[model samples]
Every structure is written in structure tokens, then in C-alpha cells.
Target: MDKEEVLNEKYDEKLDRQDVEGQLELNEEDDSPIEEVRVTVPNTDDPLMPCNTFRMWFLGLLFTAIISFVNQFFYLRQTQISIGYSVVALISLPIGHLMARILPTRQFSLFGTSFSLNPGPFSIKEHVLIGTMTACNTGTAYAVDIVILQKLFYNDEKPFIAGLLLVLTTQITGFALAGALRKFLIRPAHMIWPSTLVTASLFRSLHHSVEREDDVGRMTRMKYFLIVTFGSFVWYWFPGFMFPTLGMIAWICWINPNNLILAQLTGTNGLGIGAIALDWSAASYYVSPLVTPWFAQVNILIGFILVTYIMVPWAYYTDLWGSKKYPILSAGLYKDDGTAYNKSLILTDGIMDPQKYIDYGPMRMDSFFALTYGVGFAGLTATVVHVVLYNGREMLDRWKSARTQNEDIHSRLMRVYPEVPNWWYLSLFILSLGLSFVTCVVWGYMPWWAVLLAMGIAIFFVLPVGVVQAVTNQQPGLNIVTEYVIGYMLPGHAITNVTFKTYGYIVNVQALTFTADLKLGHYMKIPPRIMFMAQVVSTFIAGVINLSTATWLINTRPNICTKEGYPFTCRSTKTFYSASIIWGAVAPDRVFGNKDGALYSPVQWGFLVGALLPIPFWIASKKFPHITWLKYVHWPVLLAATSNMPPALPYFYTNGLFLGFVFMFLLRRYRYSWWSRYNYLTSAAMDSGVAICGLIIFFAIQSWEGEFPYWWGNPEDQDYDHCMLANANYYGEIH
Candidate 1:
């Protein structure tokens, strides 16, 4: 792709202002006042530019399909990883320009419309739209979990059509909310969706190049990205495949391999006190070290320390929730005797039998696992309180101000393109609801009222939660709250419980995801109509691919979703299925209410604890003006830090925070020039390289047994990181 001159010459900020001003109000400020937005995002907009062209759809849909399938394929594994949209950013740019160079430009009439295969150079607008489409694959279609759960665990005979519509309705339904909330979430200069800045910065790096300058050593961003990506690709082989133990270098556990206490305190499966990840996937898994602001990462670090170091250890050592019967940390459901919970014994005809439950006894979890669930409860309420205290008035004023409030520069520039009509969003919203009702009722998933109630839950919480995410990169989830509501409402229907949670939780999540994408488009100055079209089409395609991949895996792989399946251990579904047992088949009351040995009863008070957590921070910030960090104490981000610990290793946080301190903190502060020039591009490169390499390693070699030579690095008879004692329970030693 041609670098500096072509881009600099083509996208000059001429042909603007007076042309756009005749039709729309122009903001006096040409630039975004927000520094993060201003530096990363371009101030110019070329409305006459063609973005939704043939090259975009061809490449966009292609990448979307691959990402969706790969994410869904890995989601069932023990250590699941996602291929980020940054990969799309890295790979699509060159392909896009190539298509522009090679494809025929001859115009043709199709159904009273004229179109051409090639449309100018592969514009940044097209890149932005293409990235938006691939962003749809960032999430594994949430509905696919229900499909896998039913097929693998519940043994239900649901039609493929049901799962397909489930994926479509649950995912695309959010676009309606995105359309409605653009003013509050996207247009506001204050609502700096920090992650979107990375995308904006990355696109700028990919397109614009320095012909020659001593500043960045005259190296173009494309060249820098390629170097970093290639280096990351080669480095991942040791950690990812050949020497898998490098993923978790639990050096602390190596000290006292035979001691239960030391292993429990330091193992990858335990608290991971001194463990470190040499792998990029572990470091950048939950929180992107390169992208999240220093303040947010600091808050996460505090939360992680409190939960993993202090709270969890105290609970486990003190024998809280029968902690002594299990390991300090675990990713499994258990019986009272510390054996694996026999889910099959309790389930009869896909429903929990009351007599069978009594005979089988209650399910138990490790202290860290149970407490994380409580933290989940607290995080949701904390989000409500935090948003109300921190941003209530501003959000309210924006909504009330509506179009009368002065639009930001991005908003004003976007005025050149016709906005997506309200009727379009409304049509999708109404259709998704109807389809959801049909899919649930026809397939006997959840009742019609349950669907309404779930949607109601989504509507109520979406705004407050959305506000939190819009400001901070962190988003509090709805899983805990949704499960509790439906578990108590309509218990003893396992599939229905997950179904309700999926609708209530994922509907809100999809809405937020769509809103974030809208914000990204807003920053990039892509037309709202093109943004909408790209989102809908890509989402539908990704959903189909997600469901198809899961179905194929279940149909072909023997013992899929089981521990024996090793690589395809279906670890995530176990957690999903565990929720079914706790909330659906068994009922939350018996488990979390007042039954004998109901150790988790007090955990429900997290709702109250969460509601009150933000008030102290708000008052402290107001009372003690000198203490600036008090205001930055984001309770939702804090509490939700360890939410993924069962699946996410502790080293993920430690290593991520460690690297975050280096890049986001030290480098950004100490070396401002380098940080501003190449930080985000480095992130994009690292992500792209690791993702591509991981895929190659899996398909080419890791899928087959003995493909990798066993050695000290790739151990055959012990824990990968040599935390052997950490595999057993705390006391009575269930090894």
C-alpha cells in the first residue's frame, strides 16, 4: 500500500465547513476538547468519500466469519482466547488496498442502482467500517452457550433454527438501544470511551506515514507494526505450544512443590501470589494493558489485591464456606465431601427432581469462586450507585438537553451524512422481541412473560451500566442479577434459567457492544447509515458462524464439553451448567437462602454492600478535597476485577498490571514522544501477531497428539508449571 504522500495528499481537510454548514450547524470548535479524543482522532471529515463499497463488504464479512468461528471454537476450551478486532485492523488494511488496486472499476446497473467493484483507494472510512464489522466477532454469540449446554449437558433435542434465531435475536436486538442512546453515549465529549481511542489511534498509524523524520527514527507505523507483530508471533510459540508451561511461570510454587499451603497460596489454580505469565494472551486476556487508561488499571490493581490477596485468603484459611474441603481457588462445582458434583444424578428429563436433589445433596464451590459470585452481585449495584453519584447530573442534562445542547465537533461533522432513521431501529427492536418470544415459547425455553420480564430487566439497567462503560473502559455485567431474578421467579427449569439470563444479561451486553461500536464510528466520522448496515450484516453473519461452529464441534467431537476432551474441555459451559444447577434446577433459595449449611446465604447481601460502596467514595472525594485518588475509586471496576478468576488465572491480572505499569504509566510518562507516536500501534501489532500465530499453532500442530515433542518445557507427567500439590483440596488431601 502507498504510504505517506498518497494519504497526506488525499485526506487534506479541504472541501469541508462551508459545504457542510449550509445543511447543518457547525460546531465552533473544530477539534474535540477531550485530549485523548483530540490527539488520537482526526478532526477532518470528508462526507463525499465513499466508505460502504464492495471491498469493505467482501473483506469485512470474510474476517467476521473467521473471527466468529474461531472465538466460538476456542470458547469451549479450558484456557480460551479471543482474536481481537485489532487483528482485523492489522490484516485488513493491506488486503483492502490490494482489492482497490486489482478489482474492475467498470460501473454496472443493478436493480436501478449503479455500482462498481473498485471504489477509489482503500479509504480509512472503509477500514473503520470493516473494523466495525469484525468487532461483532469480539464476543462469542452468547446464545451459543445455551445451544452447547443443551446439546452437551441437558441432552435436549432443540432444532438448529431455534439456536440460529436465538443468536440473531439476542445479538442484533441491541442495535435498537445503540440507536436510541447515541446522544448520551456517543456524541458527548465527556463520554470518552477510552478503548475507542485505541482504534482511532491505530487507524491513524496504519494510514499516515512519515516519509523521513528523526522523531520516530523515520520508521513508518506500518513497518513498526510489522516488526512488533512478527516478533510477537515468534515469541508466542514457546508459551503457546512448544513450551506451554511458559504460559504460567509459577516460580513461587516451585519452591515447595510438596507443601499444600505453599502450593495453595501460589499455584496457577490457587491465589497465584508470585506467579507470572510469560505469554501475551494471559497478560492481555481480560484487561488490555496497552489500551486501558492508567487510572482504570490502578483501580483494577487495587481490587485484584484486595480480593485475591486479602479477602479470599482470609476466607479460605478461616474455613469459610467449607473452604478447607476444596482448594483455595477452583473452576469446578463440588459435593460436600469435596468430590466433583454429579450434575447428572440430580437432573431428570432436563429438569431438577426434588427427590434427586435431596438424595444428591447440595453443590459447593471453593471460597474464591463463591466470593467472586458475591463480588459479581456487588459490582452491578455498585455500577448503579457509582454512576448516579459520579455522573448522574451530567447524563441527565445530556438526555434532557437532547439536540438543543451544543453538539461536539465529531457530532457536527457527522451531520453531513444522513442519520440512521429511528424507524429502522424500531423495526429491528420490535422484530427481535417477537422473534425472541417465538423462539422461547416454540422451543419451550422460557415462557412469553419471562421474555418480557427479561427485556424489562435489560431496559432498566442498560442506561446506568452503559454510562459506567462509556466513561471507564470497564463494564459491569448482568449475569448475577439476571440469574437471581429468574431463579426465584421460575425455578426448576434449567434451560429456562440460562435462557432468561441470556436475554436479560446478553441483551444489555449486546446493546453496550453496539453502543461502543457506534462511538468508534462517531470518532472515525463514518456515516451512521453505513455503520448501521455494517453492524447488522456482520452481526448476523458472525452469529450464524458462531452457532455453526459450536454445533459442528458437538456433533463430531466425542466427549465434548467434558474433562476427558482435554483441549475442548468445554470449561465455560461447565460454569454455565453450574449456574443452571444453582439457579434453575435447585433454586437460589435452597442454595443461597436459608437451608442448613447454606454458607452462601450472606453472599446475597452483596446487593446492599454494593449499593452503599460508592457513597463513601463520593463523600470522601467531596469531603477530603486534597485526596484526588478517592474520586478515582471506581467501585464497579474495583469489585468486578476478579469476576473472571475461575476461568482467568491470577497471573493474567498480575502480569497485565505489571506490563500496564510499564507501557501505560512509565513509558507514557517518561517517554512521551515515543508513547504518543507508537503505543497504540504496538498494541494492535502485538494482538494481530499473537492471534494469527495462535491459530496457526492450533490447526497445524496442537490439534494432534504427539505433534509437539515432549520435553522439560512441554512436560508429560506433571502440572505444566509444576504446581502439582496445588491440584488437591486444602485438607484431607483429595489427591
Candidate 2:
């Protein structure tokens, strides 16, 4: 029989059963085994059943907006950027759960075709949607540093203008880059969007529960919500004045409070031999414990070891040994007067110390050297090639499918969801770069040639970094820092430098990484618009918060922030400023210099290194396809210097063991159906708690000036031992 004939017969039988109501019991429908499984994969072409989008708006959009603004105030603590997506997910849970009970729709719209949320249990799909919206929030951390620029260079005249321009620059550039490379990035089966797994899991649980719901009771979530909120507000203010030790505990790590032995042990000179207790900075390094599964822990381990231990020690040791001078040493400089030079004053205080001004200041202009033209050309070529090769077929298929409905899964998915194509995106990217160059020129911040070079270089290099971040979760910002060295080598009269140009690379990597992660959420039935809006709202909010705090605390050198000869030290500005300098100026010199120190000066050499490192391994894998050991070895992680055994020890001891213990002792032992349902939410709850705690600690103590030891010493506020800032009530009096 034909399928239509069979459906007609079934319809007649259903009608007959309804007519004979006494014999046909409604409760019997619940006994069907198929009804128990509640699988909701929609037919590719079905139109959605109408349901109230108003409820979705409240649950997903509004909730995310409020939460994101507040969370940005705390966690990211940047007025210049925000974390709106976090709130989106939090609010989504309530919406999905509540809406599941009332006006549930099996049909939803995708390009006018119907899709299904697939009627099932109330779950966490709302969170997934929200996460997707916040994807663009990735690069704002760097872009928002324009606030600092405004204060120091522009006399804080147009903070919002700088911020807005930077934001537009980053977004336009990223979108252009992503569009150009979309085919290669999105189409590759080998490129597993790892974050997609998390989003998919959340969506599946929320919309398809044949059994019990896989989440906590509303009360448990509310309890956590209250606890985190109270903790965030309370701890944020406690260290401000009352019990100043709240900040002390976070900033200080003393071996002994008073003794000579203690001073030697706890000093920053590397002689310390104290049992290390977790400070906010060290503890904050522990974020790997939350999201990194056992399989991906190596990248986090390497970052901790390389930066926290090896690179830092090497840099510090070079400063001390003096025999083998690492060209770029500490944040401070030894000036002609023989006292440590004050960098904050030189950079931000707008004051020339007046001694040796002509001789020393000459080299400072090299900081903004032009070399981006070459890199930009290369980047443009790579982007075009990438898309043409990977996306051409897919784009054609999509076009054909749109006309005839003869589309496969990918095409159908694409059709239902229209995204701006590569050409449009690339145009925006180039245009933004041009506009930003003009802005820099107008402000007299960088000469047009120097600005173009920076723009070109940034544009060119963003491609490979984007690829790495999208493909592998690992990042290598040092790769770009090494590139700036080459920029210095180009026969230029000067350069416009930021501390670490590699930060640009890091931002690019993060942009792609976060976007791909959000896409995973997209595929799992989260609304793209919600995720996009949430991310924008959060980014803006974070930018403002970060800018205000960063400026007030980190910019006002020798007053709000003391650099040198001040009684108390403030390292926040020092650390931030030095970091920019190293990447922007120093690293480039080291990498691309004619001097002995410029060993690997050109930044592209590192990219070449990164590319070369993987070839042999990839070739081997292709040549010997059946090697199980080879399959286990992730060469990208290994080649990128992303694996460190040291940090993994504690991680393995705690989280590794914990995951194992839970998997074996609890999950396997219980074997109950309910266990599977609630596991994801259980994990999410813990994540939310930790994020809240870390954020509170970050704002209340970490950003403050002159806490444990200010970056500089004030001559007036000196007692023989500690000191104070100028405006204090006890100013010039010894504590």
C-alpha cells in the first residue's frame, strides 16, 4: 500500500476510536512505548507550530541582558565589555522549563519552513541559545583597552568614541575573516567544533526527555542563585575599608610576617621557600578545572607551566644574572640617572623627567614601526583561497536547494538560517581597517604608514590564528609577539607599539574559538538572535566596566597608581602596561632585530614554525592511517608548546580523580535512570558557583591600587617599612 493510503486508514481508525469513546480510553495513549522516548528531530521541511514568542523573549533575551550587564560589572570587571550570554543561559532554564509545561510547540520557523523543538521534557535549551548570542564578546577585552589610550593620549576626551571604534573594528574584522574562511572552517568533517558538543548535550536534555528531566529542582537553583548573589555583593565591598585584611589575604603571600628569615623567604627575588597558599591570582589560574575535560587538559597545563613558571623565571633570572641578557627584561628601565626609570610617568604622566630627554627618547618612536603591509596581503590571499576551496561547492548547493528544496542536511540547515555571506563580511573587514587607520591618523596617534602596517599585519595574521582556535582549543599568543620583531626589522623611521602585538593574535584566536563554540549551541536549536544580542549587550557592558575601573585604578600614575619613588607599590598598571610594551615594542625587537637580541624577530617566522611543526606528524598519520598510538597523539597540542606536565599534577589529583570517582563510584554504581537526567545541570551549578566566586574576588581586591605592595614607593609616606598614597588621612605618617 502507498504511504498516503496507510495514513488515511490510520486516520479513519483514530476517528472510529474517538466515536466509540466508551471503548477508547485516553489514558491508554500514555502506555505507548514510543511516547516514552520523546525523540524530537524535526522533518527538515516542516513549518513550526505557532507558540508564544513573548515567553521566549522574557526567558531568553531580557534575562540574559540584565544578568550580562551585572555579571560584566563583576567577573570581567570591564566597563568596556560585558558577559551578557551567561545571564542568557541562566534565564533560559526557567523559560524552557516553564514554557514546556504551557504552550509547547512541535513546530518552529526556519526560513519559513517548519522545524520542531520536538515536544519533550522541560530542560536547558534556553541556556544554549543564550550562549550562542554572546559569541562576539570574545575580542572585546583587548579592544576596550582604548579606554586607557583615551586617558593617557587624548586626555580622556572621548572614551566612548575610542571604545566604539575599537568594537566596530574588531567585529568587522572578525566577521570578514570568518566569512572569507567559512568554507574551510565550517565544512571540514575533521574540524570537530568541540564546544558544539556542550550545546548539543544541553539542547537534547532540555527538549527530549522520555524519562525524568535532567536538571535540578527549581529550589536548588534558586538557593544557588541567592548564595552567589549575596557572596558577590558582600565580598565586593568588605575589602574596601572594613577588615582591609580581606584584600591583604588576596595580595600578600608572606612566609613569615616579621623575621629576617621570613623576609628572605617571601621576597620576590626568587629566594622564597614558603608553603604556597592560594592567592586570588594563583587560584584564578585554576579555571582549567572547570571546563577542561581530561582529554583536553594538556593545553591548560602547558599555559600554566610555560607562563607562570618557565617564561617568568627565565625573564626574572636573565634580569638577575645579567651575563646572558634577555633583550626584553623587566617592566622597569635603568635610566641615565642610575635610578629605576618610571614607565607610567613616561607613558601616561605626560611628563619628561628632563634628564637625557634627547638621547633616550629617540628609540621610543621605534615602538610604532610599520610592517603590516606584507602580512595583510598574505592574510587576504589566504582568506580568499580558503573560502573558494571549501565553501564554493556548499554555497552552490545551498543556492540550488533554496530554489528546488533538493537540499541535503547542511544545505537545508543553511537555508532555514540565513547568515551573511563571505563577500559581504570581507568587505566590512577591509573597510573597518581603513576607517580605523584614518581614526588613528586623525588623532595623530600613528602616522598613516605605520597605522597601515599595523592594520595590514593584524589582518593578515588573523587567519591562521582563527584556524587554530576553531580547530583546537589551544592558543599561542607568543606566536604573534614573535612576529612584531620582524615589523621592527623593516626599514622604517618609527613604529606604533602596544606592549604585546601577540595580544592581537590572542584576540583573533579567541574570537574564532568563541564563535565556533556558540555555533554548536546554534545547531542544537538555540535561537541565533538571542545569542548574538546577548553577546553584544555583554561586550558593551564589560567594556564600560573594565574601562572605568582600569582607568581610575591603573592610569592615574603616582597618585591613584604609584610607579616608583612612591612609598607604596601598585603593580596593576605596571603589569598591564609592561605587557603591552613587550608585545608591541620589545618582542618585535627581539624577534626581528639586526642586533644579537633579535634572533627570531619577524612574527611570521613563528607562524611558519607553527605550520612546519605539524606537517611531519600529519604526513606520518596519513602514511600510516591505522596507527592507534598516532591517533592518540594530538600533534597540534604538542607542537604549540601547549602541554606542561607540572600544572597537570594538581589538576589530575583533584579534577581527574574527581571525574573518575564520580564516573565510577556514583554514576556507575547508582545506574539509576534519574542519574543521567540531572548530571549536566549538576555540573552547570558547580560552574556557576565558581564563576561567581572568582568574579567577586577579582573586582573587590585584584583591581585596587596600593594594596599589598604598590608598584612604586612614595618618599613622603615612608615609615622605614610600609608606605601610603598622598591623599590618605595618615599621609606622610608611618603605619
Top-scoring candidate (TM-score):
1
TM-score of 2: 0.58
**All candidates: CA RMSD in angstroms?**
3.4, 11.8
Supply candidate 1's per-residue lDDT for 450: 94
Lowest lDDT sum, 10 consecutive residues, model 1, at 14-23
Candidate 1 lDDT over 1-735, as tens digits, reads: 465336435543333333334324535376678766765776666776779798989989999998888888888886677888777887798898788767887997889999998767678889989888989668798889999888778778689999999989999887777788887888888788888887887787777643323434557777887899899999998888889898888898898788889988898877788888888888988888988888889989999999999998899889997888987778677889898888889888888887888788887888888889888899989988888888888877877885736777778778888899999999999999999999999988888999999999998889888887877787888887889999888878889999999999999999999999899888888888989999999899899999999999989888887778787898778878888888888878777887634668888889899999999879989999899888888998998898878788788899999989999999988987778778887877888789889878776766664357779888877478888777678763763
Per residue, candidate 2 scores C-alpha lDDT tens digits across 142-250 of 5444445445432544545555555455444544455444444543333445434333443443333222232334333334444544554454343322333332231
Q: Which pairs in model 1 have colliding backbones?
A: none
Q: Candidate 1 clash total?
A: 0
TM-score of each: 0.94, 0.58
Number of the top lDDT candidate: 1
